[model samples]
Target: MKNLILTTAALALGAGMAMADTVRMGTEGAYPPYNFINDAGEIDGFEREVGDELCKRAQLECEWVKNDWDSIIPNLVSGNYDTIIAGMSITAERDEVIDFTQDYYPPTASAYVATSADADVTGGVVAAQTATIQAGHVAESGATLVEFATPEETIAAVRNGEADAVLADRDYLVPLVEESNGELVFVGDPVPLGGGVGMGLRESDAELRGKFDAAITSMKEDGTLNEMLKKWFGEDTATYAPDGSVVTN
Candidate 1:
């Protein structure tokens, strides 16, 4: 009876460990159409759908974690989460500290928006979210770069004239522009930046990364990824072709 009791206790402990292996998917809940808090206060957006599907396909129990954009990567490194499903672009600079699944979203352009179409985006003060590729590009583009902690603040800077323009992902800016009632407009030619968006994982989680990469590939091959992209980003958004190449509109 003593040996049986010990065995049962050990089995219970093992079951609890297995249950605790839920993968935490980190994201910035502020970025809409990517990841945001819905009316129900739950993570809801394209990444949420994609992440949930990936988790299902990979057979991994997953949960969503919201983190600030500025500290997202650092928190991931500190083991605050198991993966970053934020709309993080894959970059060589970031790859130094973390691993990434294969590209889930294709390379997209960054555009400058302002109150007028003729805003001096190339040579004027430009706002960008800090620590993003858009911010880095603005810093080197000969434009005076104003860094904001959040994407919303960058747009507010442009609206209030703190910056002449705000540079951000075209996909993120399109809806804002349309809803602006002519208050905002694209000011300059869209600049291509970053390779593509991918899931960021710790450097040590190669296996976990592989699972997601495979799930993404499966989605791509089955045309589900393209469907999701179009559903969230509009019909003209870039998508994966049958040959696995990106079909940009």
Candidate 2:
């Protein structure tokens, strides 16, 4: 299923490769609230709102292209997309390959969710999205890591007993746990990972990166970034104030 999605995205991107003047924003339109395909089959969510504003402020003509998460970075390097505005975290390893704009979202916690409260998240099989920090963490934590191509598959793995638990961003898991009622529950302490979420760009596109960085800085100064974060992640989350201070609950 994941392969099919990637193949379709590749074919669609091949149909009309990016022109010289237009910027193509690449995202994994599968993660909700951060990014997702709405009922209308269009990309919609917090990153969508933030990306649109950044483009407007940077005065760039931009278009959004959905890609599977696993190949998001490679496709960007291949020129299938101009910028990756996905909920990608800024990390040293990733920095070795692509330049990143200043973070639009602050560092958040990764959490464990399981069908049983007694599930040993630390010692048993844990599921995470492939190529994500959570997966990397699980791999090094002495736990058996089972990687899935999508967030939904990780949850499914837990439900089907294929994995003991699923580790993912806390904000993304909260709603799912609530909706699951007594079926699923958060099972361990939240683990902090990554620096923050930033936009990925080609190293040669320093000008483009600077434009987005400036736009993000402007939004931070005006408090618009915090407002959008609150709207999507909720008011209780840690937010950046216009005075450059972080306020947390």
TM-score of every candidate relative to the true structure: 0.90, 0.91
Q: What is the lDDT of residue 246 in candidate 2?
A: 68
| Cα lDDT for residue 156, candidate 2 | 98
Question: Model 1 TM-score?
Answer: 0.90
lDDT of each: 0.82, 0.84
**lDDT of model number 1:** 0.82
Top candidate, metric lDDT: 2
lDDT of 2 by residue, 58-83 (tens): 99989999998988877887788889
Clashes of 2: 0
| After superposition, candidate 2 runs with Cα above 4 Å error | 1-19, 243-245
